[model samples]
Target: EKRTLDVWLTVNPADYDGRAAALLIARDVTERRRVEAERARLALALEQATDAVIITNTDARISYVNMAFEKFWERRQSDVLGQPLTVLGAEDPEIVFDMQKTAMMGRPWRGRLRHRRRDGRTVICDTTGNPMRDEKGDLVAYVFVQRDITRELELQEEYFQAQKMESVGRLAGGIAHDFNNIMTAILGFGAMILEKMESDNELRHAVEQIVTAAERATNLTRQLLAFSRRGVAQVRRLDLNSALREMEGLLRRTLGEDIELALRLDPADCCVMADPGMIQQIVMNLAVNARDAMPRGGRLVISTRAVSLDDEFCRTRVKLRPGNYVHFTCSDAGCGMSPDVLARAFDPFFTTKPPGTGSGLGLSTVYGIVDRCGGHVEIESEIARGTTVHIWLPMVEAVGEAAAPTAEEETRGGSEIVLVVEDESMVRDLAVRVLSSAGYAVLSAADGREALELVEKLEGRVDLVLSDVVMPVMGGLEMAESLQEKYPHIKVLYMTGFSDRDLTERGRRVPGERILLKPFTRDALTRRVREILETAKKARTHTEAEPS
Candidate 1:
């Protein structure tokens, strides 16, 4: 094998006793050359590394810095050389001292570290610092490795916030669903009592107050349902511009004369598939909130832009994906929120308004609506400057304008057989009383399985089945699927506590128009049942007249 040999040579010539003498010496320095080469390579690698590297002496004074470190700190190496760690504005003096102590003890100190720049900007990094020792075990220097993780930390915070919001939403939804049953019973029985009471009765006013309170309570539950994403949504593809323009008049009126509403809509088509009512709720809630903020005169600008988000644009936001979207913004020149208040803006029941003035579900409902539509919402505000809320809704292909709904037919009492299924005894009893009083044959069951058993024992014709959505043993949707297999042509209607969309049996869906919402008056209960039967009768007549 060939070996590299570095040599040092010296030659001398001298005259002694009139005679010339020459002397020569040579030595190999291969190992010394190899070590020097290695040191140069290591230095070069550190200088070119992406992560910032800093070197300090045993006393914790800055000795060297890589190019990356200079760039990360936005300073020149000349300015930082021979300076203490404090020169970097490390924020916490105690933390720095502790880290140094750990490093001096021949242990690595690693974790998230924050550095404050002169510009008042914070730089969060995943930092690791360790002491370097020589062969004699003497500590020589300390090396620090820091990777910028500021953006990553921010993204993690957003994810945690989203999880928190989801948890609160689920809690609110469960509570609202249970409350819906109580409201339905109260409203149904109270309305029936009022119908029988004389107009000049002494107790009429008290009963009316009770009914009014029930209605208002029902509305509060509705808001809670919205925040939980448990409200009914009849979604359809519609133009965003038209939806806003239609609401312009209402928004202006809601904002009052003090606040001027400005509509700056994009000329391009901004079509999106969404519930009209949900869209209306989003605008109205934001408008009302902005109006409250302004108290005095101010400008409220509502604008939309058809934007195409690329992968780069969506990378920072975990909830967003790259696609065409309508960038809807509502900005108001009014007193803005502080950082502390903005942090909890999407939390359910979190409000800065005085008690009884705000239900505190407005912004939370806005977030839930956007989330339900597979979109994202963001808000930014500064004290005394203004507040701007941005929403991104996915765009859909253009479709024709939706047709206006037809007028309702007359509601008339019928003698058809009706089956009502409900888990709540109060709601079930109220439904039975209301339908029986309307002159219809009624059968009731506690749950879907019980209803099926009742139907099997019946010998008469069952004209319609009205059932609640959620129940023990068997749910309404599962029972409906089973019944349809046996009696395919029997009329069926579902009444739910909240959210028709949330009802599904192994991914099965029903028509939104067929599902009725809870907290109905006595008249609504009878009227809806009659309407379904009437529609079924018309369809049967039309089928018979058609050519076979």
Candidate 2:
């Protein structure tokens, strides 16, 4: 009988005897060697791939790591090999333990796992691990594949930012639309009253009150525009300390006799790059919030100082740039907020006050305005300790003195024919009455389409088109375009209850095109209408003088 072996064998016998009966035996091993070589090649290929490849023994000790894993850890394979799987930088140690237990149980584990980078930065990664077993079905090791998705996360963040901006724009537009309508009614009615009232009479005083109310409503619309980033910001270098000092009287009146308003301005000049109107709004809103927090009498301290924030200050803060800033601090000795409430305080429509008592937009508006102006905000509060809000606006090099108030011109009347287009019958009637009493011949239209027809029929006789921006059927913008094409001589004045962006596609208000917000008093309506008519008349005279 021949002794058979798996590999080739050779026999050699120098002296053949009873002791050396079977000299040598050899069998072919080429097939088995080739098979083993093929397996090794496949394993090497998988290990060296760009995706992170790692192998761990059944005990969860790391056995192998490929080039990808080595690069990911910023270490050589020798450093990671033989290390426990937990040492491979899983952010959550429990996660690694859970995965090892599952893999040891002969089940595959796969899911996202957060891991720390060589630089100590944390990143989320997609990970999958499968139990590797021998032919006898005993667990040998676990193979893991990981993919870095930092870029994917960055892209998602960018997408979210775009969506947020779009949503904010829409919200601002809607608010402006409604506000413009209300202003239109108020202003139209006020104008009619002013036209019929005799100077220095009881009726005149009532008309003045109506006008004041309308103006305040106008201020609110402007605030909405500021929050929406659609309002025209007259940016100038101004000392905040001076502004606060000037606003002391107004703040005292606003907070009333119950609340104590205190100022703690730093002696150092704290100049900022901001719109004076917007700054006032920010101060006013914060003060109002402080007042609300203390339904009973409380102390409100408004202060300003120059601040220099370092890198350490920015680590725990969101959306903050480390630099010098003019810090406006508003502190109130009133009911404070819990951690949970403080977290959501800056979010729009998130209010702690009872419904109808607050709009919840105050803080959000302040935040938006500050952010748009390249600033940051920090809030500190604890239950029963009261709250302090610190707003940091970027400091700017002072170039000029504080802005001076412009002189108000006397009310002027016009004789030009003006077309008034408004959907609301009451508003339109009031506008017609005001304009007629002011010596301007007015043509009224219920909507843009009606106004267009009137303009086409009247042709050159119409000097200006004062139309409501939002109306049923044809909108004001479309009508303006149609009329402008036919009669280039006609000037346009857009009126709306919404923001200026409602009329402009990209939030840019056209130059020379007057925009009047709604809820305006009779005086404002009359003043704007008179101004537009006079400007049109002046332009016409100038054109005639130009000699075409």
Candidate 3:
């Protein structure tokens, strides 16, 4: 085959004996030319690549940057040509040192990197830096490829935060359940003690003090339950805008004269299904945190808006679902938290204050309340740059006001057969004694499993089943489900210290389900039992009266 070969040739006229002579030299250059062309093609590809690419000198000074790098850094190639890598990032020193060390050792470095842009925005990047070398293995330059993963990291953080909050909530709920069971026994028996003692009894004063201490413990347990997302809140469909307006004065008074409270409420009613008191508590908690943050006084702005969270918006949030949301934000112009502090800001009992100054449950309670309402919570803070708490509650159609409690005449005693199922031995003993004293045949069981066995053996018809929501072996809901099949006519009265999502949803309760929240006084327990039995009696009478 005939072929053409590119060659380098040089000819000079001159030479031998001063006569006409030519000296010529020729060498092949085809491979060198082809290699140069290939290099140019690769360089162009890198220039247009989606990932940012930069070529730096041995000292890490930028020598060249591709188009992608220019756009990603928001800086021109000309401006950054002679600049050091620090011009693009004030990254963690350790990461930079490690990357440099690996590259200097003639190895490629790959890692997650923190970078900065021309606009001063922080970015996270998955970066790979390779030490480019000549054929002789001599180091020439450092070539780096970086993919911006800032948004990805944020989404991951949101997911992890949701998981952490949920785990903590479960722990808190468990603790509250245990505490509530103990308090139920203490308060129940104490009430029984006081009911018998005369008004002038000397030991009655000591017993009153004991009851007072137990009541205080109950309040603490209530707060813990609130943080656990299993709170016994009296929820109602509330308009966020109007609710804030009503709370503005309390917030202002709480902040005192130095701090200013501002409300930028949405004109459109932002209604949500939440406990009115819980809503107040959430706002109050945020306000108190803001006030403490700004000890020297700063502006605390609380804003609300009706927002629709689309799939894209909800995708990053683990617990959040796409829907209409009431966006409630509390922002403060004060000394904010550092990165370390911000990470654990939502943790229960995590506080930055001096000893005895804070309990650290404020934000956690807000977290639980929002979680219970099927909402999202986010806190953004930077040292000396202030803090902002963002809460998104699922919006609900405004219904009529919270239903008023049904009026019924109080009952002193009842002859109905009552079955009490409680896991705590002391609580069970207390319930048995109280119900037995109330002139009823009270049956007792340790838990759902035992209760089922007890029910099966009983020959007489039990009028009501008083069961604890949470118990060992089996839960109240499971027992109730079984009861529904076996005894459809028997009435059920559920007693719980904290809320149970499995029993019923957090906000909405079943219409006819009767719940007695602990630690109830003996009178409250007896009254609730009698009420359910009486209602059942009327129901049976009406059923009999109806023509078949």
Candidate 4:
């Protein structure tokens, strides 16, 4: 191959020899040119790379840093060229020592580290260091490639939190399922005993208190279910003002005289689709949280209004949509939360209060309830300033004339053959007592399997089956399915504390399945049974009257 050459001329000898001759020397520089081009290519590649690149001498002194490193470290190249590599990210002494030892052996070291930037901000990064060797095979330098992984770590934390919540949900759901059965017996027997007591009897008041306490216990379990996202919401178009009004006295009593509980009700009705009991629980939790935050007493303001959110407003927030919404706000002038505390306010079992003082599910349950109701909750707080929680729920028109419950209707009952299926002995006895007192022939079973045998041998005479959804041997849904095949005329009612999602997962096939929650009052149980029995009788009469 032909190639161009670098040439040099020697003319001094010609001058000395009085214009005699000149000598020329030529050398090929192709290899030198190719090496320079390769070096340039590598430098350009390092400059444009996204991951940070740093070069340090064997002594751990920084020698060169790429553009990416300069930006990522928030420093100029000149500022860090002669500094120790430790200045870049030696937060963990052990990690740095391990990396140094590994690099010295001409090996590679990789790790995730919390590194401090030049600007003093800490960041999580995935970093790798490889030893660079000279032609003699002696280590000369160390090359480091690092990537900012703060967002990745955050995503991983969120995923872990989600997994944790799911685990907590399952655990809470299971506990609540069994606990509900126990509470049912407590509340049911309390109500039944109180019903038989004379109004003037001294024991009547004590019995009434027992029933009240049982109801409160039931409420607590429901809150736990809410945190697990397994609690069902009985939604209604409710006036926020009315609900708050009803809770004012209870809230006042709970907050005590030192804390001022103020209600800023809207002039116009603030109607939203929500579960009334769940909404009350939300207010109760928030109020209790505010109370705990202000041990010295502070002003707690509960307000409601109708607000219109535009697309622009919705764009800046998550879990929000542009529409008219009922804005419910609870603001408290109490010791506020730090950024760290606020960030994890919705994490289950995460609490700032002393152990046993709080279950730490207050805010998490509120978050779950608002989310389930197609709403969003936003919280704002500063270190010393107070905190304000803003909840926005989609507004709806006021529902037409809701009939108030009368005393007569509350105690109403019916004559029907009702089968009660529950695994708990106390709960089964309570159900039998309540139904028998309500003029119904009540049959009891310890489990669904036993209930199935009872219904089968009863020869289609059972008018309704009020059964617990979960039990040993067989579940309520399975037994109900079997009953449907054998005695299609029988009505079924499923009572459970499990979430709707759980019910579906357990293969609930009854269309529009009716589920009455646990710890239901005697009146509630009797009224529901009568309603189902009446509906069934009317259906049977209609079917008989129809041309078959």
What TM-score, over all chains together, does every model reach? 0.82, 0.61, 0.75, 0.72
Q: What value of lDDT does candidate 4 attain over all alpha carbons?
A: 0.82
Residues 1-548, model 2: lDDT tens digits: 88543686787775566464656767688788789889999888977788888888887878888888877766688887787777766777788888778866768888777877766566777789898989999998888888877657756753564355457757776776666666667766676667767887777887878878877767756665666666655567778999999999999998989999999998988888787878898999998988888888899998888888888876545556798888889999989999799867866667988877777778867876787788877788888889999888888766666654232432556788889898878677877887787788899998888888887787657987888777799878888888889788888887666554555774434442477656655566667877776677788798889966
Candidate with maximal TM-score: 1
- 156 Cα displacement, candidate 1 (Å): 2.3
Quick one: how many clashes does candidate 4 have?
0
Expressed as tens digits, the lDDT of each residue in 1-548 for candidate 3 is 97777899999887799789998999898888899999999998998799999888877778999998877777889998877666675377688677666655657888887766666668877889899999998888988899988878887876676676667666766677677788888888888889999999999999999999999878766666777666676677789888888988888999999998889988887899888878898998899999999999989989998898899888767668888898999999989999898888878789998998888888988888898888989988988989999999999887566554444455477888899898888988998998899799989888888887888887437888898877789877678778768888777888886665423543334333478887888878887887788787888899999999
Q: How close to the true structure is residue 363 of candidate 4, measured as C-alpha lDDT? A: 94
Question: Mind giving the per-residue lDDT tens digits that candidate 1 earns over 1-548?
Answer: 89668998888997778899876788787888889999999999999998999888887888999998887778799998988776776666777777767765767788766887776667787889988999998999999998989778878877776687667756656676678889898888888888999999999999999989989888777766666676777789979999999998889888898788899999999999898888888999999889888988899999999999999878766778999999999999989999899988988789999998998889988988888888889999999998999999999989676554333443467899999999999999999998899899999999989988888787436889999887899988889888878877678888877555345422546678887788777766777788889889999999999999
Look at candidate 3 and tell me the lDDT of residue 359. Answer: 82
Error of 3 at 189 (Å): 3.0
Sliding window of 10 residues with minimal summed lDDT for model 4: 7-16
Query: TM-score: which is higher, 1 or 2?
Result: 1
Runs of candidate 4 with Cα error greater than 4 angstroms are 1-48, 55-123, 129-133, 136-143, 199-202, 235-253, 256-275, 301-331, 337-356, 367-383, 386-411, 444-462, 472-474, 497-513, 534-548
Predicted structure 3: lDDT? 0.82
